[model samples]
Target chain A: MARTRLTPEREGELYAAVLDLLREVGYDALTMDAVAARTRSSKATLYRQWGSKPALVVTALRHNKPVSLAEIDTGSLRGDFHAVLQRTDDCQMEKDSALMRGLSHAVHESPELHQALRELLIEPEMTGLDELLRRAVDRGELRPDNPALKYIPHMMIGAIAARQLVEDRAVDQAFLIDYVDSVVLPALGV
Target chain B: MARTRLTPEREGELYAAVLDLLREVGYDALTMDAVAARTRSSKATLYRQWGSKPALVVTALRHNKPVSLAEIDTGSLRGDFHAVLQRTDDCQMEKDSALMRGLSHAVHESPELHQALRELLIEPEMTGLDELLRRAVDRGELRPDNPALKYIPHMMIGAIAARQLVEDRAVDQAFLIDYVDSVVLPALGV
Candidate 1:
């Protein structure tokens, strides 16, 4: 095996730098050199750590996102979805949300990046959401095989992310409320 | 004013070449030289017409999208959404869809391109969807102020586009049916 380098702390610094650069330059213009310069790390350090631009960008995004979900016990599926989507709204509108923008550009260009992103940023959060929905089904809130559950997360975030990238608009709390009340609650067959 | 040099047909040919280059190479690797070669036009000719890469790419996207909506009287809100979404699915999954990919990448790097794309591609489609929804409300099939209606078209198409870009997946007839049953009808309070 070639060697695994970078302590978790060092990785955190690198990701913070990447986040700053993403906000300043957006994804396509973000350069590894700028990341090294910002983090006071050598170019060799980044190459040794991440191996490629896509890898580095992916790591940075994964780092920025809340990969694990809070335990959902709001006592109802509708309550849980509203809570989850509320957190989603917060993440999308974070103070410096270059991670979302970077992932949008990266996914569009590279399938590898897209897959990694789907696994790291999208899948984990949704796995938690899926668990919550499964609990709802068990509780008879939805059909046992309600297919809409499969695509709901994709639909909710997809709309917001696509709007952000295509319209250059920022998501906010009010929009999330409207989205959940108007889109998700109904789509779940609630 | 300088005399208009390239004929309309020649301009169309060059724009078509830009789209081809975008599909083949993506925005990062695409260049005006490649476009000139692809179209069999001189570099000078391209510059004289488009002036820059963003302008050229934006024009190509604008020229390629079929913006005119089909005047269909499906006589129901859900029916109309299904019809329109199916039409959009066909356009989104076309083989030469690098235009979509390139535009997605271009928007990441250039806010100007993002805004232009919204104006040229997203806005036209969204406007048609909005008008369709408005008519449905007038028919009392949907509540006039249902917030979900505002986001439904975006949600449906966003799901398709995001899936296509991220998962190498495209929207199909079955996906459309699921969307109507789960999202459209519920949002209309049916």
Candidate 2:
């Protein structure tokens, strides 16, 4: 079958459709046929573009994530952390949580999906975070070899995810601030 | 239909079958019919005993967990944490990780499963951890009103889970010790 070229706008539509289907039916039950039907795109085009269900889903997740890490600088480590936390709060709406929950099992089951999620979706954010932390180290706000540096992403993001999972509570701005002040800053010896 | 009374040993067998099936097929794909076929138990008996697939899976996870908090204390908070970490290492074999990954999406989708997981598998462990922390506070090893106390579970377990999900690394005894010493202890000002 000849491939139909999708414009950037059309690509975004397909991603939105995939994410919507993910929220409704979840990863396992979601099918390529459903995505094609929802988006009014050809199944062959989807396969041609993304190869498989895991590939399409991974690409959709990556595409949906706000990958701009350019505006995260805030001078001090605490300020930078707070800024990032605020950004996280802004992006992590209920629908995003549902998508994350839906993909959680599939990510673990498929190495390709896990790699794509980590590298494409999660790594950009982590890189941005690390850059902020590195600036703090350079500015003498933190020590060069703080062991807690290794755990910042895991600590902050994990706390947010775990809170939602274990307690069903949203990690709002207030909670993020509290987490930074109580758990993160203290652990870093700030 | 007459209900079959399963002995404690038979009940254990059924739980094992459920967990095994969950590992093989995941929460959404697993069926009561499959469970009945695997265990050679009547579908009516399974329904009578567990009510639903979520209930059965939750019960199976709870049953497999080493639920005794009685053996967690080891005098000092550090010692107690180490003991608990060791037990966690022993219990969190490859199979357990697989089950956890399998159930991650389902837990979010079903409130019943989420509650059952927290109550049965997670809460018992947390209660034990909190008791140890409380004892430490009473002994003046930690401040009575430290805010970081609320986040200990999230930090430790979250780090372990995050490492597996992102880095594909096992949360071994060494890593747990490092986490407790560097992250947990320092945050507690111990």
Candidate 3:
């Protein structure tokens, strides 16, 4: 069956199941058959709806996001950055960090998965982030050619990904807000 | 059967084999039996020598590093940061990035692996980094209590890890050097 056939409630359940399976087994080990078994759906139905494992997995990941970065406009870069964090529940960051790490390796091995993830997930988030920076630049808050501009994603990702690795700490909102104020904002001369 | 009894050349080869197995498979899927088979050594010797899978893997990971961060004192934080990269061959950075990404996920699951990796691998790197930062602070090049002091590792790690994920680009020594100049120094007010 098509994805639209499912009610919103059914759709939410399926997406949650897919993400949980991904966190447990990773992309290489995850199978449409396993997804089917977990969701009590048929493999053909999944394949029919999403076209491939990568598409299905990426769609589920997208659905998990609580807010879109593109929609945020708080009139200041600091406000936008903090607002982005405000939208994401504090508890979700740790699990999301773990999930991204789990996929980081898998992304290296599968071009389709990488493409799907970027196109569906990372690209939009990046575009939204770029827009936020653009607005800041428009307001004369940042230089147009700051080399650090390109590295915002890297810095943010590093903060989220490296926190657990280096310090054995969960990435709570408090840490991220501080990170933005002390590290990110200063580096950008904001 | 002890690792001490092996010739230095043989020990290096065994360590190389262990690292190769780790890269091809991840920590959880990797086995002592696989390491033994790959290296043409007996599993008993492996256990007697390294004690466990996590220990053997961590030991091999340590052996692959070309420089010890603690041994480097370039007399300045920037010089030492660049020196650390100088010691690591540029060609190896991409592979090391992938290996770390691979391990990042597994590190979340296995406490033994986490302990061994932090104790054997990450801790020394942090210490060396800390020494470098201390030298910087002592020289009055940076503020003693700068919040960004703790984030150097996270920033550097992010630059390497997120390059491929975000930009689909390989991180070379040149890229790292530029990162040090652009993002890192400015953040530190250096």
Candidate 4:
């Protein structure tokens, strides 16, 4: 329904604006009024289009993902992983990480937002990632029952979340690439 | 210093109160006013003891750790890892995880909180973890030049942080032990 209401370029612009506002004002402080004013749209239009702030924010995040992991089959799992890092630049990754850190807290308090995030952003990526890993197993890279398989999502998310807590740095391309090459690959015996 | 102002028991009571408030209301909404009310201390005394809310909260988290990872030396890395998990009950671990999740977002907005968390909670744990890993390497459990060594913190923290995001569950001891047994240990070639 929303897709039909706006042109593709206009929808892209609206999503970008939503994310920019989210970065400037956190989820708790963010309001529909601010989103409308920033995008020069009316509150009614925003409500009609997104239904709610949580859904809007989650949809924007889904729209902004640099690459869908499902589309990444580079013939090698390592190559696929590297391809993910290459799709987004360091600055974008830092912004995305910051946005995610902000969202991580909000999700705890609001089940609706959590549900939207899982449906619109997290689950889709996870599905794509599942396929990526399954292919690795299919290629004899990792045993099907490799216990590490279940924990890959945790390791990937943690790599970003802990960087700020541990080293006080953003998860850049180099650090992530190194993590994949060293920690993830070695753990998987790839 | 704050240490001299109160007995250890009283100081711990105050820190426990601080953490309770932090979990109930996130860092942004938590205030010295609420803290003083909860602990039956004056606002002036609260400031006198901890200097600021961020400092006080970070100190509380440090005080609440179930076990200091640095003190763990169970003759092997596996033993030490398991030892780290045994010190805390699952309920407490879930609480700490929630508390940490609350603080994770707060640290993004407040440099003071971020600095205090790193200094009080993160750096100390990291120092202990570094020694633990070094001991493992010394015992020929891993190559000193092993690339995975650098990312162990990432993996460890990631496991906890990612659990909620990926699987929507708390990090229980059973799951954590298995993670260490399967993912972390295997990654290190242990």
Candidate 5:
């Protein structure tokens, strides 16, 4: 007797294995053979599901990303930013966070991956943050026109990512909050 | 004999060859054996000059990084920002610019190299830009209590680098200038 069902849970497991491979071997070094071995799936299965490594990688990242922004009713722009940063802080602390290292490596090498990453990983979060800022602008918690607003997401998330990519150290959440309040808020003239 | 005595220019040529080897092989793959073979120099000579790959790579970067920042005498803060962005535009156009790729890779891989890259390559430019901004603050071109000042350099450079790193496209100078004028200057209340 054998478990013959290809369940959704099995798909999720395979996708996670792809992420692990992407992180361990990097973009250039990642191979289907390795993914098959790691996932305990046949190479035929990977090929049947995803045509190539790029497709598999893109699919993995799409699944790996958070489905949507947290619905935060923190009542202030600063509070919203804090909530968002805290969520991101938790994600970065995960040991198997391919979102930071592996997928980023693929982005560097492939334009298609980069575009997919921005669309899947960056855009939805930014759109939500933008909506939050819009509400703040209406409420007078923030200036209507903040230049730093344009770069805040990049600075907060991208700065942490950039530092992680460089130092391979855990990001300091307190320092990030201070940065938001002292540097980002004041810059926005909040 | 084709040549017996090596000129100073020949020494510089040998160093350039070592750098070319670095680009081809990357830091970890680069070796004194490869450098000596490529440069047609004795292994003893490379060992006598630069003891290790890091030293050689650092030397090459120091020698190669073109005017990280030039003093801009633009009396207005807007003028200085515009000027700096223009220079950044030019630097971003070079395809074979090892300084960009190599330093980026080095910074990501090694902390010691990151510190050296920051100190040697980035700090000088930041210092000059800071001095220029300090002068602007002194002249009342910027607000005294502006916390955005800290984020400005990171934001400006990060936008350019992030766009390039993710998008694989050249940063538009006009768009950058507009971004500064419309978003940054207005946010600064200048």
Candidate 6:
């Protein structure tokens, strides 16, 4: 493979192209050729930069995620959660959800993709959420020994994904707030 | 099109073939030709009976689901949930999860399949769970006006699905019980 040096902007364009194709055709149907054609880049360049479709898709998803959760301190756990949930730009959320839905099947079948998703996308966000929750524990807003703590990410993120999958509904801020107030907060004994 | 009278046993065989193929190849890669070859049935017969791949896959999934939630009364809400969660035959659960994972991507892209899944598979289970929760409310185990009542199905089912998707873990009886005790019960203020 010929090595190609891609600028940050060029890399972003490739990522966008991959995500667009992912949403349009899904993981199984998407091809490196299509991504290269869409971005007007050679397939060799894409392969050289990302190595494979799963690697490219994972990198794309990671690129699209919020860079930092450090700015999400709202002093209270509920406020912080609501802030984080609402932090996704509305336009981006639609695309991200579509990309996520598109990747769901492939992720299960491919261990490499699944591991990359956990390591690159989910783990980082989870680490951020965990940090926020720890701050709440420090503030006496929650019990340190609460078993619910282990499942908070599952509950909140899962609820959103489940609502979308089962009900075909978009999870708006109102729904997130209600979820936090009624389900998450109560589970935390707040 | 050749008119074929499929016996009950023949229909079961067809459903099994579809699900098995779905697990092995996934929804995108699964083909009517493959199903026909697997079941030793004509492609014309499959199309005549199920109309399309999505239709056949959805029918197969619906056929595999537990037929009745009527027998799930365990007197207590927690017991009922545990019973329902554990209701799937263990061997079947593995196959079903694989099938579900395989269908995840297609479910989002195909509205007809999505609607069929919600109506045939999800709604029925949600109805059963809702009925159980109502019984709990009547027994004064939970408040009728509690906001968490609206999200019980999402919480329990979502937590299980989320665990599988994110953590790649089997949601066994012990995990469900702990989830109920820690997350669901606390969320419901029990």
Ranked candidates (TM-score, high to low):
4, 3, 6, 2, 1, 5
lDDT of 1 by residue, A1-190 (tens): 1335768787787787887787777766778788888888888878887787777877777776553454866878878866665655565665434456555656666777777667766677767777887788888888866556666766766666655764466766776666777777777777
Estimate, for each residue in B1-190, the C-alpha lDDT of model 5 and write its tens digit.
Answer: 1233567688668767866776676666777788878888887766567665665666666555444545686889898888776764444544333345544545556777666656655566678877887888899888778755655654555555665554456657775786677546755667
| Cα-based lDDT at residue B74, candidate 5 | 81
Cα lDDT for residue B163, candidate 4: 84
Best by the DockQ measure: 4
True contacts kept of 3: 0.62
Once fitted onto the true fold, the runs of candidate 1 whose alpha carbons sit more than 4 angstroms away are A1-11, A21-60, A85-92, A95-97, A108-111, A165-167, B1-15, B27-59, B85-92, B165-168, B172-177
Candidate 2 displacement at residue B184 in angstroms: 2.1
| DockQ, all models | 0.41, 0.55, 0.67, 0.81, 0.31, 0.57
* B55: Cα error in model 1, Å: 5.6
lDDT of 4 by residue, B1-190 (tens): 4468788899899899898898888899999999999999999988887888888998898899867888899989899999999899999999999898887877878999999888888788879998998898888887888778878778888889888877888999999999999888888888
Listed in order, each prediction's TM-score against the native is 0.76, 0.84, 0.91, 0.94, 0.75, 0.85
- DockQ result, candidate 1: 0.41
- lDDT (Cα) of model 6: 0.79
The candidate that wins on lDDT is 4
Which residue ranges in model 3 land beyond 4 Å of their true spot? Answer: A1-10, A37-45, B1-3
Instruction: Score residue A143 of candidate 5 by CA lDDT.
Output: 76
The fnat of each candidate, in order, is 0.49, 0.60, 0.62, 0.86, 0.19, 0.64
What lDDT tens digits, residue by residue, belong to model 3 across residues A1-190?
Answer: 3668788899899999999998888878999999999999999889888999999999999999988998999999999999998888777887787678778878988999999999999999988988999999999999999978888888888888778878888899999999888888889988
Cα deviation of B5, candidate 4, in Å:
4.4
Model 3 score (lDDT): 0.86
Model 1, backbone clash pairs (residues 3+ apart or across chains), number: 0
Ranking the candidates on lDDT from highest down gives 4, 3, 6, 2, 1, 5
* Cα lDDT tens digits for candidate 2, B44-160: 888888777777788888788664655666778888877766766534665776777777667767798888777766787778777888889888899979999888877875676
Worst 10 contiguous positions by lDDT, candidate 3 chain A: A93-102
lDDT of each structure?
A: 0.68, 0.77, 0.86, 0.87, 0.65, 0.79
* Tens-digit lDDT string for candidate 4 (A1-190): 3658788899899999999988887888889999888889999988888899999999999889867898888999899999988999999998998798778888988989988888888888889988998898888877888788888888888889878777888889999998999888877878
Q: In model 2, how many backbone clashes occur?
A: 0
